[model samples]
Target: MFRTLVQNVPAVADTSDTSDTSDTADVAVIGGGMSGMATALRLQSAGLSTVVLEAHGHAGGCAGYYRKRGFSFDVGATTLVDFAPGGVGAELLDSVGIAPLNAQELTGYRAHLPDREVVLHRDQSAWHAERLRMLGDSERHRRFWALLDRLAQTFWQASRAGVRLPVRGPADALHDLRAVGLSGVPLARHLNRTLGDALRSHSLRDDAALVGLLGMLVEDTVHTGVDDAPLINAALGVTIRGAGLSRHVGGMHGFWRALVTHYRGLGGRLRVGCQVSQVVGGPGHYRLTTRHSTLHARRVVCALPAARTAAICAGLPVATRLQTFLERDAQALGGACVVFLGVPEEEVAAQELTHHQLLQAYDRPLGEGNNMFVSVSASGDTLSAPPGHRAVMISTHTELSGWAGLDPAAYEQRKKEIGERLVGYARRAYPALGERAVIAQTGTPRSYQRFGFRPDGAVGGPRQRLGNTNQHAVPHDLGGPGLWLVGDSTWPGLGTVACVLGSRIVAEGMLREKGFAR
Candidate 1:
């Protein structure tokens, strides 16, 4: 159900303004996140006139940033993965002659467990040694790693080839077949299986600690626990270090600014502080209703949450099946919370902490007071913090139901409690946290709603659980010709890498519709 926040939605009034012709475009992207920017740039590269509409003052969406006092903190995402040569971000940036930010290589995140502290390094050899030293080496562990390695490699290759999900046309279906080739046969074998099933197959299901760790790691990325995590994506989550992960020199916002700069340089028009209220259209064209103007476009790309997308599509000439699917996908998703902190440089230097860390508690649940993913900036990274200060971003998965149905006072109390609990966990993991803590703030799903423009301030896309993987994922096309989705809400799921990949798929779809591709 849509939140009752808006008591009455304004009806779309028919406008016959002749001056509105200036707002028309070959394609209109309905969100200015990384995905929307990528789609607009790619379309322009293909010789199509494109316009981008962003609700926020800037781009980046969930991967955006906020500045307070003299400190800069990430609004949502802290780290970026997939910086390799042929990666999605790499290719996209290269297309516009934009160089990526100077990123520090992340060996692996430090996981603070109940019995031991372990580091999962990017190098396979170092990771193996650390794993054996921490958790007694077992045949089950070896088998699971091997399987994930194979699946992850294949998944990367397929993603690089721009494999579209929930295929809508013959071109996409054929592309999927060609991209997978013979190697992806193994992935097909486990199409219906979950990570829990794989653990059982390897006789590792009895290892409670290992299962708990896997659940902790996956719940952040896949939006589901180990028992329900889809095997294909779970495999990628497990082997995340195999590819590469990095932190931008300034922050996430800097990276987004680079993309936006390159996009505008390529002649793409961006309209910030412009929110599309409804989209009503047919096959070849779309009429988008914004707060102050009614824009017309030959193609519409919605880079937003499923519920929000469904709300707009409800006013369109879309099929019943697609609208129903979007509504259901929205309800199936969870939420996320992030805590930002500013600490003095002296305390951070004394501890010599890594850029990223994952702290997990053995006795409690993952989000409440048990698990957190933390990212700290280098002491002298002036863009994030001054020379004498440091910036820290902490996040955890949360359910929307926990935040709903509360009075204003109760909601504020619950938010404070969660923020304090997360701070406590961070302090425990990094003892120097309290000593240098200068300023602190918390962002909830509602914060995300305000800044990221997602529904209920939800984080991530829908949960990619058992029945929500591969072809079962939400379709990029909501069963409407020339309409598409290109973000975490669609197939390929969440993360910066997935968003870029999904963007390319949507770009390809648009190009095909324009007869630019087969």
Candidate 2:
């Protein structure tokens, strides 16, 4: 069960005067997701006047929550890692004055295969040892762990350095040099020559168990195959071991609310239900024409997808290289998710199931409910469910184009069918799950598009390809002066850590441009 630490801090009454806009701020942040919120809060604390415009009524984007009949459900992410002490995510939260909660540490992740159940322990050494033991005395696990450990340490150093500096020209080159220096080799070469060759040569071809385990890891970490993903990015997951992945007390939305509270406290202004229509560069300033009114700022940070940026800045010098990168990166192949609520605690309690379970049906491929990751949040937690009822969230990846041409009626039907299939898979693990589900809802690529404001309902913006991957070519630079971009489309792809890290990079860039000390 998830728990919260109650701090008796008095609420700050809403002091925003929407009608008053005489002064232009240092920055105008478009989008109020975690990345946007992080940027606005940090810039405002640094004594820069900042305004955040959110198209949605709420702050969180995909990380938002929904409620139906006393049940609360997280729309996007359910589980998060690297939020422990000394971690970048934790440091970001603390820097904004949001107190961290004492979260319950999950013991292991259940991996269901055709013939056996694999419980991936939280401890790295123990998890590697168990895998070696399970594989019947194979030494491959030992070698894999050693390589993963080196990669993780190097990636951590890169993440730390990247979060602090601006990604431009020679500075970006130096950053890459520092990352390689720390890692002792180029990230791409290391992945292709080491991790890639090792897995292909030995395990993936022979061991079904190893393939299943690696499949789950790759799917969870990069939302893609091992060969297509960067080793540094993949290593982030390995290093996260023993860091105790935790869920927000109420739901992911509660975390968003907490962040908004912190943002407001830092004197950051947020305007909701406001959509940016155009971003025109004025002399030494940026004019953001919104659906309602126009605002001006010395800098404008667009925390949106590449397509959205293209839509707003229609007349800018349009970075052709960046545009090409966005086009190539637009492949959203991650699958859809089906969330169920109002599950009875007693049904799953007897099975010793807490809030999480992984379901695998031997009849399907790895991406098609062959393995389903399940999470449960207790009822009346004000975060996940109503009193006495539980919330279940399940996710799997699919090609973005799969749901492209369906009409509304067809879409709804598809969702129902998929939801039923997932519910059936869940039943194999917990027999009584179907009877306990009071509410069944499905989020397709179309739903993600409607809710997340993504062009193609790409859950994680722009897939990070292995080679020709320009880490600096990310659309963080807005193609002109006084404009920037943040969010998942930036350097690091997805996850809470990536969003926060992208925000820090944007803030640092803006600060340097404005002559602020590091």
Candidate 3:
């Protein structure tokens, strides 16, 4: 069971004043998501005057959550991973003097593949047993697991030590080279390789069931099927149980509030409902135009998606090409469609369940109706559900363009149809979900655009394929003098862990530029 997220600390005074509309700071971070908050808080703690301008009413971005009819649903980010002691999340929380949230340890999720059902256990022995049972005790399976285990270990260890790809500048390049050491050498060979490459190497590429299973897992995590998912990231994605995945006690919304509390308690200024319209200055000195006022800062960290970032910097001459590149990348990313449900507890009393569940049907396309990642809150968790109800959040990838160019009525009808289809499919896993299961709400890419201010609700970061891995991925340093990008769209790619790591990378680069450390 997870610990309760209960931290009672005295509130720090709002040190930086925005009431006078001074609109000046040492550093200004755009988009108060996970990355933006981390960057601003770390810089403020480092003695830099920082302010966070977020378009949304709350922080957490994709990690935000909401309540409806007494049921709480996690909007996008459902779990906290890689948060064990000394892990990336742990280290970051430690630095901020904030304690880790109470989380329930996941014993791996149950994968309902097309042909078979398998429980991917967190424990090595259990996983080995399951692998042997489903994949058979063959040398190919052993070799594949061996390679993934090694690659995952190296990738995670390097991340824990503060090493990320897509070096920002000379200082970042130097830091990366040093962080690589000998452990990262093995990872280099797989930089350009994909899960398919490893499968082919083991002669298991033709195993339909194995390929289907991994494809489901990899596609959900890296936004690429096994055929194209880079080995380094896919390896980490497949073996994530070793790192740890947990559900926050009160849902992700609680986590967001906790993060905001910690940041504000540190006297860091956070201004929600402030949208950055444009970026109009150069390195060393930049001016950001918000809906209400214009703000200036010496350094800026942008945590918005590439499209939004590009729009914000459209006024800069050097950023024209950068904006174009970001636009292209944004178009290439997968869109998200989420469905929330509230079911009576008695409806599914006979079945066993995990905190997270993934099911994929191989016949359909990669996104669309082929796959779904679902999360269900434990019964009696009043924070997320009523006493006799269970809250469920389901999501899957969709083509961003599909939601565009539709009339308002058509869009609403399409959303309704998709929601019904998804709910019908979900009942396959939870058979009790008949009319008794209430369809609380459904959200599409358009919903994300309205709330997150993203162009297409583009999420899950960049696609981690053959040509987009490691050094080839979108960079943290945008080559602008004082401009830096953090979050899923760059460097370490997507996920909460990647965002935190990216923030650290940006923070370190900023400190170095300030002559804090090498």
Highest-scoring model, lDDT: 3
Of 2 and 3, which scores higher on lDDT? 3
Arrange candidates by lDDT, highest first: which order? 3, 1, 2
Better of 1 and 3 by lDDT: 3
Off by over 4 Å in 3: 1-20, 168-174, 327-331, 348-352, 515-518
User: What is the RMSD of candidate 2?
Assistant: 4.6
Q: How do the residues 446-501 of candidate 3 rate in per-residue lDDT, one tens digit apiece?
A: 87887767676677776777776578777777745578888877778778888888
Per-candidate local distance difference test:
0.74, 0.66, 0.76
Give one digit per residue, the lDDT tens place, for model 2 in 184-299: 65544664442355566556434666656665666666666555655656667544544557777767756766777777877788877678889887435778886557888877
In the predicted model 3, the residue pairs found to clash are: none
Candidate 1, residues 1-518, lDDT tens digits: the string is: 11211221111111122233347888899887778888898888777888888777667678877666566677777877777678767877676567766777677777777767777788888987887677658877887878877888887788777777877669777888788777686577877889999999998877766776777778777878777888888988877766777778768755766666667777888877678888887655678987678888888888887677767777665435556566557567778877888888755565444554454555566765566788888656787887788888888888898887788889888889888878777765676674557777777877777666777777788888777657877777764577887788778888888888888877876676644343
lDDT accuracy of residue 194 in candidate 2: 27
Superposed by TM-score, candidate 1 places the C-alpha of residue 43 at a distance from the truth, in angstroms, of 1.2
TM-score for all predictions?
Answer: 0.91, 0.88, 0.91
